[model samples]
Target: MNLPQSPNNAPDADDDLEPVGPRPRPKGIYALPNAITLSALFASFYAIVMAMNGRFETACIAIFAAAVLDSLDGRVARMTNTQSAFGEQMDSLADMVSFGAAPALIVYQWALKDMGKLGWIPAFVYIAGAALRLARFNVNIGVVDKRYFQGLPSPAAAALVMGLIWVVDDAGIKGVGRVDWAAWSAFAVTLFAGLSMVTNAPFYSFKVFGGRRSVPFIVLVAIALGIAVVSLDPPRVLFALFCAYGLSGYVIYGIKKSRGKPVSVIATSTDEPDEEGLHR
Candidate 1:
């Protein structure tokens, strides 16, 4: 005879179920973009090593390579729909190494070091500026204007400074003698690049050139010509181009101000640093 089942003695339907604990946290990361960022970081590290070896020319080239790879990673992530917060932060860190620390160190070693205390000061200033700029950009990415950067981008700033070094080195103008005006020029450019990163000047982003936007055939031709020019004299041509771009923000800002148009780079509804003055 079977015993009658009491409510307390009954087998529960949930007997086979495992007790639910806190869910295991996610540990996966997207690989492709991070790999690219890592490569860029290595390029920067290589630059530093080359600089240490007194291979200044090779160091400068490595920094440029890092810049190119840095530029590509983000676009690749976007195009592949692999965007992640991890990727973004990784990119920023890689950029700091490639564009911020590497350039400052290379320039200091190549030219500024000869100036003694004066040398390290400008290098420090540039490194600090790059740090602040990267921090600000990370915070402002969502709110800032898509078409303009709030200040000179750290990469472009690095390019300007490093490009000068590369050009001078290529020209065999070692900043070591009474004729080393090139060293003085490097000093000035380092200071300028450092200061520019923290300014309110709006630099065109060129983001519009990406995506599915169509361009005239002349644009392609212009791009081809640009590549050809860069190939002809990498150091001189690239430095000149970056130098012009570094100055362009000021010109654009001046034009907008004269026209009584808004000059703020941030597009948010909140008050930006130059917004009030722009309106006035």
Candidate 2:
């Protein structure tokens, strides 16, 4: 007959080890980046409030301020090594409010509201596009080429629309006959900005500048000059810059197609296990 097994036998030890479930999320989120995101969200809300009060220019400025804050939060998170899933989700939600809903509502109030029910359609379309764009971005963040965005980013699209309003308002162009033209212009820009958000065209993402990259001294000089030029005529200069950027994706797409390069913005599938379902 076989002897009885000891309490510390290998099979008993294996049985005593319980299976672990999936790891729980960290106990607390990083605060700084989320605070910045909340500030951006407040800026968006302020933009909407100012728009309602007929302070369109101030509202436009608020959107720009939100954009600046939005840009900072991600960099801050990355730099401080405090990135978290919560921060990413918060940032996207803030972006939707600031870059998507705020712009649509502001433009509608500034121009589209007077066009009857038809006036609101474009705004709704824009809101929808922004939602779709943000959702796709969240899902595809791991899959896309870091150097390029598959469609116009929502913030840039908001800039294109708000920039037009800012420049026109700065020029004091909202009287009688001018109001009608401005309204139509706002309508067109809003439509273009909204539709562009859902396009397949690839927009250049300036992600290449991050990390330990060194820059030439001339870059600093250029930045100073650019700041001075913007100071000289903030509305006109900023609007012109964003307009060019808003159209750049089509330019890049056309160039790539003409050169016989595959123009699809989707990053190619890789052999890595995590990337299996991430082709787009």
Give the distance in Å from residue 241's predicted Cα in candidate 1 to where it truly belongs.
0.4
Worst 10 residues of 1 by lDDT: 271-280
Q: Pick the candidate with the highest lDDT.
A: 2
| Candidate 2 structure quality by residue, lDDT tens digits, 203-234 | 99987764678778898788899999999999
Q: Alpha carbon lDDT of residue 172, candidate 2?
A: 78
Reference-based lDDT, residue 142, model 1:
81
Question: Which residue ranges in model 1 land beyond 4 Å of their true spot?
Answer: 1-27, 175-179, 271-280
**What TM-score does candidate 1 get on C-alpha atoms?**
0.86
Instruction: State the number of backbone clashes in model 1.
Output: 0
Per-residue CA lDDT of model 1 for 40-146, tens digit only, reads: 99999999999888888898888888888998999888898788878888999888888889999988888888788988888999999999999989877887879
What lDDT would each prediction earn against the true structure? 0.86, 0.87
Q: Could you estimate the TM-score for every candidate?
A: 0.86, 0.87
Q: C-alpha displacement of 32 in model 1, angstroms?
A: 0.7
